[model samples]
Target: MKGAPRMPQDDADAPRFARRVGILVTGIVAVSFWIVTLLGALAVVTRFVRTIVVPRAKRTEPVRVRDVDLARGEIEFDADGDSRTPGRYSFWFDDDEGHARVGDITGGGAVTVTRRIIGVDFGDLRGVSRGRLGSWFHLAPGEFGHPYSDVTIETERGPAPAWLIPAAEPTDRWVVMVHGWGGRRPECLRAVETFHRAGYTCLIVSYRNDGEAPDSADGRYGLGDTEWRDVESALLFAGEHGAGGVVLAGWSMGGAISLQTVLRSGHAASVTGIVLDSPAVDWHDILAFQGTLNRLPEPITRTVVRTLGNGWGRTISGLATPIDFARLDVLGQADRLRVPIHILHSRDDGFVPHNGSARLAALRPDIVSYDEWGVARHARLWNYDSDRWDRSVSGWLTGLEG
Candidate 1:
């Protein structure tokens, strides 16, 4: 029978075919798993660079100025959305001497007007150029003519530049100010006025990888992991100067750095108080919120955190060794804060979550004073309502005095 027709043996053929099918399925699954793992690793690397790298300046928006009606004291320009977008904006441009001139925004539409142009010093705006006016909402200290000295503080890396503005009423208490991620020293100008008025010298600081400051070996941010040391150097500088004690004030990521400096730096005894504006109290929460905003699922955030926190995982994610994301959890260690802390956070903050701030305040009610605002996003508490911000900080200072 075998030689003549090879009569089908169903039992023998079926097992071999089934074994082949099983092998195919197993190979498919193994390939799929590797592909997914590679993709996840790539995603982690991309997020690492974007989150920690200091972004370069983009070329200025192609002169959006359409027209300038000198007679009516108005200018026409394009905005991100409707020019009528409700918020404060300032008209800015370089004058003949290349000094920045800014004027208050009177109204916004297709056409907008500016008032009290700086440098020109003309009411209703005069000596204004028909060229592009780089409008900004955040005001810099240069516009106010507040005298400040450019000083450098020595850090482990190198010298980092800072702006030292002495208070008119001059007290021994120094206020060291740190700006947020991608923010410059000018961002502290709003808080500077309040601190100066309270008789505190203000030191607007620049840390590693901040362009003006010396670049880190990796040229990537530690998210307050290593930047805290630069802040410690600034604190030492203040102590060497006329500062009897210091009040550390920070905005956004700056707040994270400030918190780390307080907790880790040996200079904790010198820092009497801390003021955080929309701070990233817990990096874990912030990353999770960011994942939500960017439409990434919880698993991706968890993977990212794990990748950033460990050595081998960081290598896969294209990060240098030693990130220390665990230490960025300031809220987790709220009880460790010995000095009084004042936190100003916005419920509408699009970046860092307010829950961490609230939790920290609740956990250490005896040492932490929480002030909530809903007017603006991220580190824009002052821009939304400067009067209220000033009053709050001033009140805290008064409380410290008492």
Candidate 2:
């Protein structure tokens, strides 16, 4: 008779208890200072790697340029939409800044044709204050339908997606293009086009939480963790389709995924070269840089970082907050790679900074060829001055194979 259980006194009390406990823990963690920061860093890194395997949208053959004589034939179109070109053609531009049909020569002769330009705007982030990162990620899929016609590859997380443009001549060399955060497969067409012109089959890939692959298994982005699989799958698909050699190229965070894939794909002997455009080397450092650029309070930024580490991170990542910068610790893993690396970055990349390209170039000097330009925005050096930037990077890459 004395073994009776006590009934709930008040449901309201339970809420109060949880709230009070939460406040106390927060205060404790805040007082502990560096403990939370360290934990946050770990959490961010863990979720980032987890994102390496998100699903992607399938892309079929999309119309893109294949060749340029470099002398008599000029790709006459402006890339940035400045409308400075005197008498070039008009083309559509798809970039981070916004979507707009641009006048020829606005992009400084980056494009030779005015039919359909595959680029974006954001060079002048002067007073822009809107949109989430997911908005950018979904932009491409929404704009252009999936553009590939090849066998679909599956990721541990889900099926890796891409826009495949098979070479007309079938050079047996495949170039896989990976986009940065807030970007989809076609976003890299401007860069991948150069590869295609050089006689290589091209594959512009889209990762989960990006483009049409927004709802893969993880249902959250892990930075390059799950995204890296998309690149890896592209390489394998290229190999199976008769690619004698493989080229992995990435922009921004996409560069980190490319690095990780190159290091991990020891099984793919065909992957002979790597190309990084303004890639970050360390996630920790990148967050600080972005934080400074965005003017976020140090305390709040660090706190959010710690919370990321405390949880499974899926919930945090699926949140798709802007605080989720790139994690590029892949340099440590680069030690396992046996291919040549080609890096290009501008000293004036106000956003990504130039240290990343420098460090990556140094990671494998024996097999790496590094180049740095001046005053060019992220991935826009070519658009600013096509004659100069394009010639430099394109010539270097071509010379390597010759």
Candidate 3:
């Protein structure tokens, strides 16, 4: 009694059951794969967001000082991309107790490059073994033959320190100089002489979380979304100090902040012009360029950008408020610009790509004067060629006066 005669139904049920089980197993594997992929993407997004919002710790010493020849007025440093770059730069050592300016590369070997010492502002370079290189070649306003007073701008976050360098002649025309991300007021000192000669009082300002300024509630960078507010306070300070007309000069992230202030500030009517050096006009473009430079996947970049703009990403980015990237897009809102803009961007800008500035200039050629340069790194246009930089700025300011 072999159970019963061979039943077609039973045979069919066996195959059907096997097929159903196979389908279930495949579904589980596919779900698991997607879940893993999603988790990985989330991790990438979180890290990218943190990088944008978090303030990096100040580097104690990034460049190794190989030697310093006082008689030759030259300094030797371990050769790297920044040290080898053709331009003048500053070095701070002993926790900024020592400062020195180094100029055009004189010579180099396999691992070290020697540069002419422009001057040692305060520190004796002889005993220094390591230091940090910077683009702020001029350490103070006095270096440019102008007396400066340390002032404070009362910002929403708190009082932020600023350098108020009066013009050689009594004048109501003023220029508020904003340094880039992770930059200090000293970086703006390089442009003080040019603006001062043009009879514009220079106010070099520090914004929130820039180390010198008070930290924000979250202590995170807004990528210009929130930093612009601090700059607005600087504009108000200028107006109170008898600024009949003002020009906003900014570098790198400072450029982005200046743009936002022009668009959002109540005192914008007082602003006559804007000067942007290696400006990050579009955050999206900047972030995308940065991602590419760091070899991040396109998907990760897109997700990180999305995270920065939405509510859900606030926790991940440590942002008190979700950034409205659309508002930060100067190119998209070019028509709203009321003041003339002079953009000095280098074709070889390694940090902020020049395409955004180029597009903006092309779109608004009538109001935007683009002075494209060659071989200048980001925010170091003046360091590369001070004469050219000064001439361009002076000429532009003259036109603004007219």
Candidate 4:
């Protein structure tokens, strides 16, 4: 049989068959790999976009108060479109800058419910009354007994609006306050009360991408990478405006900005101290902590973190340049810090983990005075217990000022 002349069709068919089989196997493997890689890449990109590029709506629209039952200490209201009242909340009228009322929603129904109100009202409601606990409660610099004047801080971008609340007794030492991510300048009003009372002038500032301030190129958060420059500009403004020494009081991401400014700014020597509340010291640590809470795989988060700082990832994430995650790592660079830093962190912080701050404190106990609180989430240590939070922060300021 081997000696017989082989037919042309038979010889051609054998080679052709082998070729087709090999191609099929190769195609299948390549396609499978491509699909898996695409999916993983998508996951990484989505997380990066959500954290860095996407703008989270700052504060929810206020719920309307339908009726107030003074006799029963309950107020009825219609919650329309994401106005669900969960846990304890504060209520204030349209004209009332004083958020002097706290209450809880006791009755839950379809659309309208009743809440138990504590404290007195702001006289009588006239116009549209809006109720919010976290945000609107903080007055815009001048309300609630603290006198404030509207001022502008000149930045590289443009003039950024701010609130300048001078202390009763003028001191060259000023408290330059920075708010958290998506937080307005008024968010510093809580800290303003404590610092103002302690005879320190407060300059609550607004940075880029704050909606009111000049928008960034992509309108994305720099995660303290670029935002720190705005903070440095504020320091320059303070120096020009008769500030001898400055105490930086920052919350959440603001704390990161403060740290970066101190490390990067030439005027760092003028910074007497820093106060960080639930600060995002290390972004990688915080992202991983949140990833654990969301039950995302470690590999995906690792990839996301890697890509966040990678140039290729920057292109994919719509960023002009790669994020400097190393710069955001205060814990890693704790030894470089020269000024005294006071950190107030909560063990139960959901957004930014307390471990990062704790590690920073442990790394430089001589420079850092860390105060840990329980049962409070990120940036709400003061809201949980106002008196205690104020006293502790005031005491730290006193030590630094003295």
lDDT of 2 by residue, 1-402 (tens): 253333337996677667766787887788788787777765655444343323333322122323322233233322332223232121222233343222233223454333233333334322222211111212232233323464456655567666677765758878878888656665576564467567777777776677555355546555565567667767777777788888888887788788777655544566777777777566655666666665656764564455444444445444343223433365556576678778888787766778766876787788778888875566555455556645665786797688
Higher-TM-score candidate among 1 and 2? Answer: 1
Span of ten consecutive residues with least summed lDDT in model 1: 93-102
- Model 3 lDDT tens row, 1-402: 343333346766777667666787898899999999999888878887887889887556988988989999998999986788877888889888888888889999779999999888786787789998888887766666668789999999889999898988899999999999878888888888788888888899999989999999999999899999999999899989899998999999999999999999988999999999999997888899989998899988998988889989887998888889889988899999989999999988988999999999999999999999988888988988999999999999889888
How does residue 291 of candidate 2 score in lDDT? Answer: 61
| Model 1: pairs clashing at backbone N, Cα or C within 3 Å | none
Write down the RMSD of all candidates, one decimal each: 6.5, 12.1, 5.0, 6.5
Off by over 4 Å in 4: 1-37, 40-44, 57-101, 104-115, 118-136
Q: Give the candidates in order of TM-score, highest first.
A: 3, 4, 1, 2
Provide the lDDT at 214 for model 4: 86
Find the candidate with the highest TM-score and give its number.
3
lDDT ranking from best candidate downward = 3, 4, 1, 2
- For candidate 1, the lDDT comes to 0.74
Q: What 10-residue stretch in candidate 3 is worst by lDDT?
A: 1-10
lDDT of 4 by residue, 1-402 (tens): 553333447766777667766787788899999999888768755765566555665444367777776678777778642234343434555444434455556786887877676665455433335655453346466565767788888887788888888888878979899998877786677787788788888888999888767877867788898888888888888888889999999999889989999998888887999999999898888888877877877877787777767888766576777788877787778889999999999887878999989999999999999999876667877766777889899899889867
Over 4 Å off in model 1, which ranges? 1-37, 53-140, 316-318
What TM-score would each prediction reach against the true structure? Answer: 0.79, 0.62, 0.88, 0.80
| Reference-based lDDT, residue 12, model 3 | 63
lDDT (Cα, 0-100) at 49 in candidate 4: 58
